[model samples]
Structures are given as C-alpha cells and as structure tokens.
Target chain A: MFEERLKEVQDAVEAAMQAAIAAFPQSDLRDAMAYAAQGGKRLRAFLVLESARIHGLTDAQAMPAALAIEALHAYSLVHDDMPCMDNDDLRRGLPTVHRKWDEATAVLVGDALQTLAFELCAEPVLGDAAHRIELVKALAVGSGAAGMVYGQALDIAAETAATPLSLDDIIKLQAGKTGALISFAAQAGAILAGADRAPLAAYAKALGLAFQIADDILDVEGSEETAGKRLGKDADAGKATFVSHLGLAGAKARAAELVAEAVAALEPYGPGAEPLRDAARFVIARDK
Target chain B: MFEERLKEVQDAVEAAMQAAIAAFPQSDLRDAMAYAAQGGKRLRAFLVLESARIHGLTDAQAMPAALAIEALHAYSLVHDDMPCMDNDDLRRGLPTVHRKWDEATAVLVGDALQTLAFELCAEPVLGDAAHRIELVKALAVGSGAAGMVYGQALDIAAETAATPLSLDDIIKLQAGKTGALISFAAQAGAILAGADRAPLAAYAKALGLAFQIADDILDVEGSEETAGKRLGKDADAGKATFVSHLGLAGAKARAAELVAEAVAALEPYGPGAEPLRDAARFVIARDK
Candidate 1:
C-alpha cells in the first residue's frame, strides 16, 4: 500500500517538474536540466506528499512542495557529479549531466535548477505567503552552508585528512549532508497544516540518520548495478562511513534501532502516519 | 555626491554580506563564499538601496533586498569565473574564487551563495509576509531559468554557433542576461514601499542596455587595468558585441542615447531621481 502511494507521489512530482522546465528555451543546458531532474527515486517527494496526505492535504496542495524538494535534490546531484566534485560518470543509470553535456552546461543547469526549487516553493497554492516563505527558508537552511553544503564540505575535507572520522564525526556529517533535507521533507505536512512540527521533526531526525546508515550499508555490500551508481566508493577512497565505524552486523542493528525510533516518533500522529512509519522500515530493508 | 552614496551603500552591503556568511562553518567553502562576495562595485545593491531611499524607505527596510542582490551577483560571478564556465583567473583585481581555492570549492560556494541570496530575501525586515514573498518571487524570476540563466545558456550556445549574434539578438540576450536583475534591483524600493514599479522598471530597462553597451565599448577600448579583469575578451573570442556591430564611436553614441532614455524615465520623480539618473549616466561613463 505504501509502495503504491510512493509511486503516486513520484509520478505527480515528475509531471510537475516536466511542466516547470517546459518553458525553458531549447539548448544543451535546457536538455541537460530536464535530464538531470528526471528519474530520481523521488524519495524526498514521497516524504513530503505522504506527510501532507496524513495531515489531510491533497496532492494538488502538496505537489509543489514535493516538486521543490525533488528539484533541489536533482540540482545537488548534478553539481555533486561534476568533475571537480564526485567526478561521477553515471546517475540514475545514465550519464551524469557533466558527462552528457560539457561541465559548463552542467554547472548552469545546476544553478538554474536550484533557483527553480525556491521558485516552486513560492507557489501561491502552498497556503499563505507566510507558509510559502517558511518553505523557502527551511529548504535554504536545509541545503545551504549550515546544512547539506556544510556536510559536503566536511566530507571533502575528511577525504584528505590524515585520520579517518570517528563514529560521532561520521554521524554529525551524515546528519548535515543527508538528514537535513529529509528532515525538511518530513516536516512539510506540519508546516503546511500549521500543526505542531515537534512529532514530525522527531520522526524526521531519526529517519534521516537511519536512511544514511542504510546508504552506508548499501555502499559496503551493494553492487553498482543494484545501487544504480558507483558503489563501495567510501572503502575505496578510505573515507570513514557508518558501516566502517559500526561493522556490518553492528551497523544493521543500529539502523534497525533508528528505524524503530523513527516509527515511534510518529505515535502522536496515530495511524495517519503509517506510511511514514513504513517509509522508515523501507529505508533499511531495500537493497538500494 | 552619487559616488558618496554608492560608497555608503557598498559599505553597508559588504557588512551585511559578511555577517550573513560569518555564521557558516569554518571551511574552504565558507572562505571562498566570503571572498567571492567581497570587493564588487555593488551597483545592484546601490540601485536597491537608492530606489528605496527615493521612495522614503529606510536603509533597514531595504538593506535585506540590497544584500540579497549583491549575494546573487557574487554567486553569478563566482560560477561565471569557474573553469567550466568563463575560466577567468581574476575578478575585482584579485584571484577568482576557483583560482584561489579549486573548481569544486567554487561550484559549492556558488551554489551556497545562491541559496543564501534567497534566504536573505526571506528576511522579516523586507516587510510583512507578503512583501518578503514578493521579493523572493521577483528575485527568483529575475535570476532563474527564464531570466539570467536563460541568457547565460544562450550565451554559451552563441559561443559555438555557426553565425554570430546580431545587434538585435545581442539586445534581447542582454535584456535577459543583464537587464532582468537590474530591473529587479531598480524596482526594489518600489516593491518595498508598495509604490508603483513602472517608473523604476522603465529606468532600469534603459540603464541595463546602456551598461552592456558600455561594457562592450570597454572591451574594445579599455585596458585590463581600467576594466579590473580581462579586456578585449569578446574580440579575442571573436564573439560579436555592441562595438562590433556598431563601431566603437557608434556604441558610445547609442549608450549615450540609452542613458538619456534612462534619465528621462525618472522625470516623474523630479529632483528625487537625480541620483538614479546619475547612476544611469555612470553606467556608460565609468571605467570599471
């Protein structure tokens, strides 16, 4: 049942994103932008839409925020895949933006997509001006220097450090790099409905960390074909990750514990948050 | 007199930008962000502050908007100077952000700075919730795909096109490339004061074209010392510019005409618009 809902939100997010980029003039950058924004798992968008659904909001009311997060995620991937950054050649089972076009188009595509994310958040359908502004602010805070960017910067720094990061350091970096946006996504329903954000915030905090730990686990054991991108990169680079710090069995145990915590945090929402709870469980069990 | 006002606005903008970036974690990305944001002419910030001043808005009321525009400009410059983009090594007589650090740092710094621009626009001091959203919306529209980014994509396409852009094509491109943000800055005071945007919009439209023409003239005639960056780049790249279609003297005359038109657009404001008119003329007359 949760899988069907995830597909629903993903399809809706994709359509909205298509429409968003429809007006862009024809060029390699335009093509690259459309390409980069397509074919994501739409996990963030699902978190946003499902949370909103739990709060009694329709997809029509929630999809802009959903698309905003996806757009932001896509932009992050495009830039992260650049030669100067991750230097990846593939994303979502296809050539990355930099590889498909030149790096210059990739850069502009990323720049434009980032602006579009904030623009999508400013949509009038997303409640009042205040709510829209809050969405923009939260997304910026989640993705900016104090959040994802800060985390990425630290991750880069760690790659060149003399010693690997400890468990606590990896946790901090993971929280910033991956957990921040997830937290934002999970809190959308509360923010849009003007409800107490505490429960959802708690749920998101646990879920984001669990999600990253799962990614680390996948990196250690998953294949490139299954993951749909490069795998075992952390071990190859000698960079510290959750799996490296916790051991395979220990990491899996910690992830299960965090998932339980994530599910428990949604208790205040009762059964309405069942999809979110299922989402938490899915974070660890999935191969990719 | 306008120079003094520009300096005042520049200093205030520099301070606000510094504060905005100061809270970012101590890292290369943070340092690069600060470096890129510093030492610009702050022309857009001046337009925002001065426009607000003319409309009886306080610096406190307009500083956020001014600072936001400067942040946006700084990000544009940082990305534009990247190896994948313009590949410039110097800006404002100092090493470019990428040259100072590395290409990855420059890309991340630009991405974070763009987010910071919108984040700053969401400041409560910009006005009530409605006003803040308007600023964010306007800035997004001005800087996003349909505006500045579209112009940039066109510029990149032009570089490898079989035929060079003509004067008319250049004007349309420049309108998106350069005029959109200028239009936003010029309209900031009106937007903040909840006054009519038409006059300032008209003023900005002319000022932006004239500014580009002056840039072309400078590229054809001025030295790198006077331009503070690479000069004769357009000619060297064999890229068509205003001075190529219109001779150097013809470009100067057209710029003068546009300056007059820009000044005329401010006639409704009487003596209050003098600084803005001076700014328009300064667009064509200034060396850098």
Candidate 2:
C-alpha cells in the first residue's frame, strides 16, 4: 500500500521538478541541474504531500512545496558529492555531477538549483503569500548555517578531530545533518494549513533519527549494487557512526524503537496517517 | 562626497552583516562566511540604500534589504574565487575564503550566505508580506538560473569555446551576471514604496554595464595594491573582455557614455539623486 502511494508521489514530484527546470533557458547549467535532480527516493516530497493530505490540502495545492523540498535536497547532494566534499564520483548509480561534467558545473548547478527552490517556494501556487513566506523562511533556517551547514561543519571537523565523537555528539550532529530538512518537510503542511504542528514535528524528529540509523545500518550490511553507491564508508573513514558506537544489534534495536515512536506520534490522525506510519517502518526495513 | 557617503554606508553594512553572522553558532563555517563578507566597497548595499532614499524610505527601513544584497553579492564572489572558478587567493587584500579555510568551507559558506540573504529578505523588517514576497521573488529571479548563475556558466563555457564572444554576447552576459543583482538592488526601494520602477531600472542597467567596463579598464591599468586582487587576469587568460573587444580607449569612452546615460536616467529625481550620479562617475574614475 505504501509502495504504491510512494511511487505515485515520486513520479509526480519528478515531473514537477522537470517542469521547474524547464522554466530556465537551454544551457548546460540547466541540463546539469535537471540531471542531478532527476532521480531520488522523493521521501521528503512524500512526507510533504502526505502531511498536507492530513491537513486538508489537495495534492495540487501541496505540490510546489513538495517539489521545492526535493530540489533543495538535490542541491545538497550535488554539493556533498563534489571533490572537495565527499569526493563521491557516483550517485543513484550514475556519475556524480562533478564527475559527469566538472567541478565548476557542479558548483554552479547546485547554486542555481538552490535559488530555483526558493523561487518555486515563493510561487502563489503554494497558497497565500503568508504560507509561502513561512515556507521560505523555515526552509532557509533548516538549510542554512545554524542547521544543515552547521552539521556539515561539525562532520568535517569530526573527520580530523583528535577524539571520536561521543554518541551524544553524533546524535546532535545527525539531527542537524539529516533531521532538520525532514522535520521541515513534515511540518510544511501544518505550517501552510494554519494547523497545529506538534504531532507532525514530533513524528518527523523520530523518523529523521530512524532514517539516519537505517542509513548507518545499510552502510554496514548493504552492498554497492543494492545501495546504488559506495558502501562501508563509515568503516573506511574510521569515523564514529551509530553502527560503530552502538554495535550491529544495538543500532537495529534503537532504529526499531525510534520507528515505533515515530508511528505513535501519528496516532492523532488515526487511520489517515497509515501511509506515513508505513513510511516510518519502511525507513528501517529497506536495504538502501 | 561620494567617498564619505560610501564610507558611512559601508561601515553600516559591515556592522549589519557582522550581526547576521553572529546569529549562527561559532564554527569554521561561520568564521569563513564572516571573513568572505567582511571587506568590500559594499557597492550593492549602497545602491539599495541610495535608491531607497530616492523613494522616501529611510536607511532604517531599507537596512535589511541592503544587508541582504551585500550577503548575496558576497556569496557570488566567494564561489567565483573557488579553485574550479577563478582560483583567486586574494580578495580585498586578504586571503579568499577557500585559501583561508578549505574548499568545503568555501562552498558551504557561500551556500549558507545565500540562504541567509533569503531569510533576511523574508523578514518583517523589509515590509508587509506582499513587499517581502516581491523582494523574495525578484532576488530569486535575479540570482538564479536565468540571471547570475547563467552568466557564470556562460563565462566558464566561453573560456574553452573555439570562438570569442561578440560584443553583444558579452553585454547580454554581463546583464545577467552583474546587471541582474544591481537592477534588483536599484529597484528595491521602488518595490518597497510601490512606486514606478522604470527610472531606477534604466539607471541600473547603464550603471551595471559601466561598472563592468570600469573593471575591465582596471584589469588593464590598475595594480594589485589598487585593485586589491589580481589584475590583468582577462588578458592573462587571453579571454575576450570589454577592453579586448572595444579597445582600451573605446572601452573607456563607452564607459563614460554609460555613466552619462546612468546619470540622465536618474533625472526624474533631480537634486535628490546627486549622490547616485557621483556613484556612477566613481564607477569609472576609481582605480579599483
């Protein structure tokens, strides 16, 4: 049931993002941007659409927000994969933006994609000007220095730190690195509908933590073919991750607990949130 | 007179920017961002304030937009100085962000600064929701794929192209690359006041073009001490620039004519716009 809904929203977001890309003139920057944003799980978009549904917003009303989040995610990935960052040459089973084109292309494409996301977020299709402003402001806060960038800076510093990060430090880092945007995605519908946001925010906090633990688990157990990129990077980098700090069985148990917490957070919506609950479960169960 | 006003506004912008950077946690990313945004003429911010003054808006009412434009301009320069881009080591006679920190820090700093700009633009300090929305949309349009990034892309592509760009192509490129943000800055006051934008828009177009021509002239005749960065780079790269296409004398004459046009465009504001007129002339007359 969740797979069907997920695939539907995924395809819709892909098309919407393509149309957004089409608004630009024909150029390599446009083409490179489209390519980087083309393939993704669209998990963030799904969170946006599903939460919007629970808040009485139709798919059409919620889509630009959905697309904006996905585009923003794509921009992060494009930069994260650059040579000066993760140096990853592959993503989604294809050459990364830097490898496919060049570093200059990757840099400019990421920059342009980010601006495009804000442009889309400001569009009237999202709702009234107030709602759009809220999204724009929230997204900036989630993605900017105090949030994702701070996490990234911490992660980079951890790389050469004299001591490995403690479990608490790693948790805090993961919260910023991966959790902020997810929380924003889940709460977007609530923000837009002028509805209470506590339930969705709580659900996203638990789900984002679970999602990162799942990724850590995958790094240990999954193959490159299944992951569609490099695996075992945590071990290779000798960096402290959930798996290294918690052990294999311990990490799995923690992920399961977080997933349960995530599901319970949605009890307020009852049956209407079944898909989101399923999404939380899928977060841990999926190999990649 | 221009230098005194420039000094006053530049100091103000620096303080505003410093406060904005202070909001983020202390980290290398924050440090690098503050460093990159530290020293410049604050030309864009001045344009915003000067134009706002013409529209009967006080500096207090327009300060957020001024700081936001400077942040956006700083992000562009940070990225443009990266290894894959211009690979500069010096800016304003200090080390560039990448040289002072690292490539990842440079990239993330630029990204965060861009996000910070949008966040500031959305603030209530800018005006009502409608005004903020207009500012957000125009900034996105001016900085995104069709504007600054596109010009940067064209520049990178022109580097390896078999043919040199024509005089017209370069002008069109500059319009997007350098002109877009300046136009946005110049029209910001009118947008906030809900006044006619035609005069400011025309003034900005000519000013932006003249600014580029002056930079080209500086590349030919200015020194490192005067320019505060590398000089003769266009000639060193053997790339077509305004000076290359139009000849040094012709480029100077063209810039003078553009300054005249820019000054004439502001005739609508009469004596209230003399400072702006001085700014236009300063664009061509200054060594840097």
Candidate 3:
C-alpha cells in the first residue's frame, strides 16, 4: 500500500516539475534543468505528500512544496556532480548535467532550479501568503549557508584536512548536508497547517541520519547499476563514514535503531503516519 | 544629493549582508560569500530603496528587499566569473571568487548567496506575509530560468553561433539578463504598498538598457583601473555589444536617449522622483 502511494506521489510531482520547466524558453539550459530533475526516487516528495496527508491536507495543496523540495534536491545533485565538486559523470543512471552539456549549463541549471524551488513555494495554490512565505523561509534555512551548503563545505574541507574526521564530525556534517532538507520535508505539512512540528521534526531527525547511514552502507556494498551512480567513493577518498566507524553489521544495527526511533516519533500520529514509518524502514532497507 | 543617498544605501545594504553571512559558522565558504558580495555599486539596492521611499515606505521596511537584490546580483557575478562562464579573474578590482578560493567553494558560495536572497525576502521586517511572498516570487522570476539565467544562456549561445546577435536579439537578451532584476527592484515598493507599478517599471526598463549601453561604452573607453576589471575583453573576443553593433558614438547617443526616457517615466511623481532621475542620468555617465 505504501509503495503504491509513493509511486502515485512520485508521478504527480514529476508531472508538476515537467510542467514548471516547460514554461521556460527552449534552450540547452532548460533542457539540462529538465534532465537533471528527472529520475529521482522522489522520497522527499513522498515525505511531503505523506506528511500533508496526515495533516488533513490534500495532495494538491502540498504539491508545490513537494515539487519545490525535489527541484532543490535536483539542484544540489547537479552542483555536487560537477568537476570541481564530486566530479561524478553519472547521476540517476544517466550523464550528469555537466557531463551531458557543460559545466556552465550545470551551474546555471542548478542556480535556476534553486530559484524555481522558492518560486514554487510562492505559488498561490500552495496556500495563503503567510503559509507560502513560511515555506520559502524554511527552505532557505534548510538549504543555505548554515545548512546544506555548510555541510557540503565541511565535506570538501574534510577531504584535505590533516586527519580523518571523527564520528561526531561526520554526524554533524551529514545533519547539515542531508538531514536539514529531510527535516524540512517532513515538517512542511505542520508548517502549512500551523500545527506543532515537534513530532515530525523528531521523526525526520532520526530518519535523516538513518538515510545517510544507509547511503554510506550502499556505497560500501551496493552495485553501481542499482545505485545508479559511482560506488565505493567514500572508501577511495578515505572518508570516514558510519560503516567505517562502526562495522558493517554494527552500522546496519545503528540504522535499524534510528529507524525504530523514527517510527516511535510518529506514534503521536498513529496509523495515519504508517506511510512515513514505512518510509523510515525503507530508507535503511533499500539497496539503493 | 543623489550620490550621497546612494552611498548611504550602499553602506546600509553592505552591513546587512555582512551581518547575515556572519551568522553562519566561520568557514572558507562564508568568507568567500562575504568577499563576493562586497563592493558592488549597489545600483539595484538603490533602486529598491528609492522605489520604496517613493511609495512612502521607510528604509527599514525596504532594506531586506534591497539587500536581497544585491545578494542575488552578487551570486550571478560569482557564477558568471567562473572559468566555465566568462573566465573572469578580476571583479570589483579584486580576484574573482574562484580565483581566490577553489572552484567548489566558489560554486557553494554562489549557491548559498542565492539562497540568502530569498531568505532576506522572507524577513518579517520586510512587511506582511503577502508582501514578502510577492517579493520572493518576483525575485525568483527575475533571477531564475526565464529571467537572468535565460539571458545568460542566450549570451553563451551567441558566442558560438554562426551569426552575430542582431540588435533585436541583444535587446531581448538584455531585457532578461539585466532588465528583469532592475524592474523587480523598481517595482518592489509598489508591490509592498499595493500601488500601481507601471511608472517604476517603465523607468527601470529604460534605465536598464541605458545601464547596459554604458557598460558597453565603458568596455571601450574606460580605463581598466577605473572599471576595476578586465576591459576590452568584449572587443578582444569579437563579441557583439552595443558599441559593436551601434558604434561607440551611436551607443552613447542611444544611452542618453534612454536616460531621458527613464527620467520622463518618473514625471508621475513630480520632483519627488528627482533622485531616481539623477540615477537614470548616472547610469549612462558613470565610468563603472
């Protein structure tokens, strides 16, 4: 049931994104944007839709926020894959934006996609003006200097640092890099509904950590074809990860614990939160 | 009077931007962002503050929007100065972001600065939620795929095209690349006050073209020391510019005419718009 619902949300968000990009004039920049935004698992969108559904809002009401997060996520990936960043040639089982076009196109596509995220948040259909403004503010906080970008900077710095990062340092980096956006996604519904975000925030904190652990695990064990990108990069770079600090089995166990904590955080929402709970479980269980 | 007021606005916006970036943890990324944002002419911020003043809004109410446009403008410069784009080594008489830092830091700094722009728009001091959302939406439209980015993509394409860009193509490109943000800055006050924006929009349209024409003229006649960046690159690259298409003398005359149009657009506000009229004249006359 959760899988079917996830697919439904994914389809809706994809269509909305396509429609949004379609409004721009035809160019390689636009084409690269569309390409970069394509083929995510849409887990973030799922979290948004599920959270909104739990809060008694229709998918239409939350669609813009969902699309916004996805666009923002795509932008991050496009930049992260650039030659000066991760230097990845592949993303989503296809050539990354810089590889397919050029670095300039990738940079512009990412920049424009980030702008599109805020634009979608301000869409009238999202809600009242106050609600939309809240969404925009939250997104900026989640993605800006003190959040995802900060984390990315830390990661880059760690690469050439005098020593390997400690476990606590890794946790801090991942929290800003991946965890911030996840928290924003989970709490979007509460933001729109003006409800308490504590429970969802708690849920996302654990879920995000678990998601990162799983990613580290995937890098260690998952196949490139299934993961749809390069694998074993962390090890090659000698980057400290959860799986490196903890044994593979121990990392898996920690992820399970985090997933359980995530599930418990959603207890306040009860059965209505089952999809989110399933999502938490799926984060660690999936191979990709 | 106009020059003094412009300096005051520039100082205020610069301080606000510094304070905003300082809130982030100490890192090279933050430093690079601060560096990239410093020392622009603050023309866009002046337009925003001047427009807001004309609409009976206080500087405090307009400062966020003013700072927002400058941040957005700074981000564009950082990205545009990259090796992949314009390959610019100097900006505002200092090394470009990528030259000062690594490419990754430059990219991340630009991305974070763009996010900061939207975050500023959402500041409570900007106005009511509705007004803030309008600012965010307008900013996104001005800076995103259909606006500045679209113009940049067109400019890049023109570089390798079989034919030089026609005069009409240049106008269309400039309208999106530079005109869009100027129009947004001019119209911000009316958006906040719920006043008609036609006059300010008209003023900005003319001023923006004149500004570009002046830039072209500066590339030809201005010294590298005064311009604070590499000059003569446009001619060296054989890029079609206003000076290239219309001749230096013809471009100067056209810029003068547009300045007149910009000044005329402010007739609705009588002498109260004198400062803005001076700004129009300054756009065509300034060395940089």
Q: Give the candidates in order of TM-score, highest first.
A: 3, 1, 2
- Top TM-score: which candidate number? 3
Candidate 1 per-residue C-alpha lDDT over A154-208 given as tens digits, one digit per residue, 9 for 90 to 100: 8888888999999999988888899999999999877788878898899899999
Error of 1 at B9 (Å): 0.8
TM-score of each prediction: 0.98, 0.98, 0.99
Q: How many collisions between residues are there in candidate 2?
A: 0
* Candidate 2 lDDT (Cα, 0 to 1): 0.91
What TM-score does candidate 1 reach? Answer: 0.98
Give the clashing pairs for model 3: none
Model 1 C-alpha RMSD vs. true structure (Å) is 1.1
Q: A1-288 in candidate 2: lDDT tens per residue?
A: 899999999888988899989989899999999999998789999999999999889889999889888888999999999988999988988999999899999999999988988888888877888778888898999999988878888998899999999999999898888999999999999988878999999999999999999999999899898678889888999999999999999999999999999999999998998989999999999876
Residue-level lDDT tens digits of model 2 in B1-288 = 889999999998999899989999888898888898898888888889999898888888889899888899999999999999999999999988899889999999999999999998888877777778788898999999999999999999999999989999899889889999989998898887878999999999999999999988999999899679998899998989999999999999999999999999999999999988998998899887
Instruction: Report the C-alpha lDDT of model 3 over B1-288, residue by residue, as the tens digit.
Output: 888998998899889889988998899999999999998899999989888888899999899899899999999999999999999999999999999998999999999999999999999987889989988999999989999999999999888899888899999999889999998988998888878899998999999999999998999899999789999988998889999999989999999999999999999988878889988988988988
- Residue A174's lDDT within candidate 1 is 83
Best by lDDT: 3
Residue pair clashes in candidate 2: none
Candidate 1 residue pairs that clash: none
Over the full model, what C-alpha lDDT does candidate 1 score relative to the true structure?
Answer: 0.88
